[model samples]
Target: MIAALVSAGAAVPVAPPGLHWSACASGLPQECATVSVPIDYAEPRGDRLDLAISRIRTAKPELRRGVLVIIPGGPGGSGLNRPSTYVKKLPQSVLDRYDLVSFDPRGVGASSPVSCELAPADVTQTAILPWPGPGGDISPTVAWSRRAAAACAKNGGPVYDSINTRNEARDLDAIRRALGERQISYWGVSYGTYVGAVHATMFPGSTDRVVLDSNDDPDPALVERGWAASYAIGVEDRFPDFAAWAAEHEEQYHLGTDVRGAYLRLADRLDRAPLPWPGANPPVLDGNTLRSNVLNGLYSDARFPQLASLMSAALAGGPLPPTTAAPEAALQNTFAVLNATICHDVSWPRDLRAYARDVAADRKAHPLTAGMPRNVYTCAFSPGPAEPPVRVTPDGPPNVLLVQNLRDPATPYRKALNLKRALGDRARMVTVDAGGHGSYLDNGNACGDAEVTRFLTDGTRRDITCRG
Candidate 1:
């Protein structure tokens, strides 16, 4: 089956400019394109935005099942470039059965961007997201949140306000309609899982086989809040992996011979006196910056080395790793969109007192994450408010399959379980014994991957469990 796909001239079409296609990465001939989607679905005839989309067509077009859309994580991450990156990881039989498709959500990647136009200082990792103090003092965080919110309000425009998961789901339906497909199959990872869920709920009849990996907590009452709180459990789950890695490299990264001791010492030192980060906007490695780096590093196991290197350098009284400034255009646009979607999805309390109370409680519960999870930010800074929130009930077909890692640092398994339960009889779940943000073709176990592939290719799913 794999050999046939290689010879199917799948690589004939050149991916659109800014989009690259490579058979080496996807393990098959791949092509890319840009699909223009409406920024606002309510006004399908309104201003348009280009979504960078990619595809790996089935070897036997006649036997092709249908388009299998791969949704990327981050609410801010791009799937537009995923077909080439993920195709190689899928089973050959799956690749031979359907055309794989992915796209950059609006305001991300090469898609139409919406920026906050924040000051360079505001864009710094520490300043962008407020992480409270070790002792739980949130005064600094409160001030930072206000400033960040103000900057976004002053700069972000309509485009930023327009980006949200509902609209993105609507955009996916539009893509299906454009492709002339009455129904489409889907595979979404991390935040993408949420996208798939929303799509399934909104257009139940328009979906075929569906897979949601590393799912999110779909509490309509607290969308982003739930995601943020999960970080505490997620980090606790994934820390073992990092600990083992650090322990194995004790000679090289001598923060401590034991992982726990090493992590504690590093945290203590950063809290006491941060290193000067030359050329960084703030020119310093504050506690919040350290926290951000830790959170970002935990996204994948492959990044453990980077964390070790940073810890070793900091402990040795050396310069921290070089800080790369986020592209002003990308950060502003991405942040604006992320905030718009999160804030618009639900009504966050305007009471600063309530936020302070939550921050205090969170600080006590999860010291490593500080009180950052509960810190408040204003989403009203965007031009338009979120459209009326649609309650996502599982009215879809029973064709959805959910795959999840037991310990994902970004979207934890517990949260994924919540989503699975919400789907009721509309879906079945495969819990992979793994640790990371994405499953299928990435951090998933063979059993889980095989199950999803079989379901996608032959429409068969397994009722099983996996253990690490």
Candidate 2:
């Protein structure tokens, strides 16, 4: 069965011209394909999985320096769709010089999927993620964690235990080998930054040029804990952007001329009586949803107006908008995979009391985010066996360039600073004075984009910081 699966995956299909590529919402054409990789690297001769890969070939193939692999954020986010969303955003010169490639990592879209088969009620976005209650009460969080873990344990197989960053990095190397490339270039955003960092560390010789945007702290000691706690700082760093937007559109949003006052007013009202959001789990607006929406909005400033409008309607005592739902089959599987990968990658503190104490403190320090940052979730519920964590150092060749947003919410500047320090002479950092998740091509200044394009296309980088 393993040999047959491997042989089947090894076969690449041919595409027929125009139908092979299409424009994404970002207005870029993308070509798609599938790359077969071993599900378990240790058992390379065994069963294999298919990874859905996408590419937007360079406009001028003659000028192409090399392939630029894009690593998507989220142990869960799919990169299979990004080449289309991002191809047009690339500077023409960059597009003219390199093939933009991306893939959905294992346990993701079109990859050999693994599902926990959780019930809809058991896996509602809020319940599955475990946002702590107001005032840091985690009784409900504990209950949900146990239930979710049990469901996964019963339904998830060996594949569940196999999902981890180290394995994902290994899969990436396999992809590189299959592409017949001696060395590959990279552009990683958010969680993808961590993936790029690990890949660079694990197989430094296989890397040509690398870019890590909106970086994460590669602290082996606390991985997810560090990422979660960073939210307090991240929210503080990015709230100014939202504040400015609210203030700018005060007439339209009717929140307030003062951003702080407006935010406080909204928080108070939501705490007292959250507006009804049809189809939402628990059936009403709450601090967690509000917090989640705030973080989600920070990923792109364009979403700010939507958030403001929602807040305005809620303030007017109107029914909140219906909650957005994806196919449960897909989300449950993705969420389960994300949990397995995160939990299996590192060992988390198992003490429930410790989590409670930390969450309490976090709530006090950052009320806007509440205690969700420190709340217990499935990651801590059923952690898999520990694996060696990858250490990203600055010993590699100086082919890496990093572009970062100073005010990113998901991946804050402080964490990027840590990554920069770790990379040392191997990388040159381009700091964009912007607010949002990704910096390069998306939400990044033209100067920053040009600098990255030049680096990716011509192997030239500017040793300068961009303010605005």
Question: Which candidate number would show the highest TM-score if scored against the true structure?
Answer: 2
lDDT tens readout by residue for model 1, 86-204: 67777777777778888778887667766767666666556556576666676766665666677767766656667777888888887776555667888887778888888888878
lDDT string for model 2 (304-366, tens) is 988887777777887676566667887787787778877887777778999899888887788
| lDDT (Cα, 0-100) at 143 in candidate 1 | 66
- Per-prediction RMSD in angstroms? 6.1, 6.2
Candidate 2 residue 271 Cα shift, in angstroms, is 4.1
Which numbered prediction scores highest in lDDT against the true structure? 2
Clashing pairs in 2: none
Q: What are the runs in model 1 whose C-alpha is more than 4 Å off?
A: 1-36, 278-283, 321-323, 380-385
Using all chains and alpha carbons, the TM-scores for the candidates as numbered come to: 0.87, 0.90
Cα misplacement distance, residue 113 of candidate 1 (Å) = 0.8
Provide the overall lDDT of each model, using Cα atoms, as 2-decimal numbers: 0.73, 0.76
